[model samples]
Target: MVISLFFILPIVSIIREIGYLITSKIFGAKKSKITIGSGPKLFHLSVFEVRKYYFAYSWCSYDSLRNESKLAHIIIYASPILSNLLIALLINGLLAYELLGLPNFWNKFVFYSFYFVLFDALPIYYPDGQPSNGRVIYNLLRYGRKSDFERNDPQIDIKKTDEK
Candidate 1:
């Protein structure tokens, strides 16, 4: 159980990316790349880059950021947590079935899945003081438009980022 739990952590990042991909596709955005972890490439599973570091971080990029609605972007950002939460709920339900009662491993997996998703989706800052994904969305909701977002977001300068 412990060994599997250790293995599960790394895969969680992949699961989040899968969620992102699905949501992006549904919203008609083209995904350009997906990178899991943060180091030299261990290998390639198709387009996915499996890095030396695992379970630390993951990112998915879309080909074009232009012409996307605010709501669409919000859905793309929130998809990971939403999908993970769905999976956790599904597993929890399965575990509850009387004839198919699984062991503690499944229960623990569901718990960790919920924990990771909530951790990312919450607005709380990390140790490095970066805003969570949910916080980013909150900021976007507050700003309402790209022009406003660029004006307010310190990380994004409109003059520098403006494609026009």
Candidate 2:
């Protein structure tokens, strides 16, 4: 249980971020930072940062949020989910074909990878008042205001987004 909570979860997050990074680059967005953990910085690698927790969360920063098209924002926000879902499907496909015989741990990791896509993408606050990706997207579509979908000031809810 501990291993699943700490190791597998972070791995899943990192994998998802890699997908976002790739998609962001493809879209010609400016990359600012990619953090692989929470807490104090332990080291740095160009645009990447490694922190103490290293397993708590993975965050990606980009300069592509302002004034972009609604489709672009949706792609960026959904990149992680799309990426993880693809990986999960591919791995399961291979497993079904018997082309790969991964360990039980890896099998479980694949399942968790798919699970976290739904979990993280759910539209709910994370105890810090920050909205999830789903919420942000929801607000963007619900309010019918493209200009309100800023990354820094995401439309977490309809009431808040409608104010401005």
Best by TM-score: 2
Instruction: Estimate every model's Cα lDDT from 0 to 1.
Output: 0.67, 0.72
Candidate 2 ranges beyond 4 A from true positions: 64-67, 145-164
The lDDT leader among the candidates is 2
RMSD in angstroms between candidate 2 and the native structure over all alpha carbons: 4.7
Pairs of residues at least 3 apart in sequence or in different chains that clash in candidate 1: none
* Candidate 1 residue runs with Cα over 4 Å from true position: 1-5, 98-102, 145-164
**Could you tell me how far off, in angstroms, the CA of residue 109 lies in candidate 2 after the best superposition?**
1.0
TM-score of each: 0.76, 0.78
What is the clash tally of candidate 2? Answer: 0
lDDT of 2: 0.72
Give me the displacement of residue 98 in model 2, in angstroms: 2.3
- Candidate 2 Cα deviation (angstroms), residue 128: 1.7
lDDT of 1 by residue, 55-76 (tens): 5566676676544778887887
Q: lDDT score of model 1?
A: 0.67
Hey, what RMSD does candidate 1 come out at?
5.6
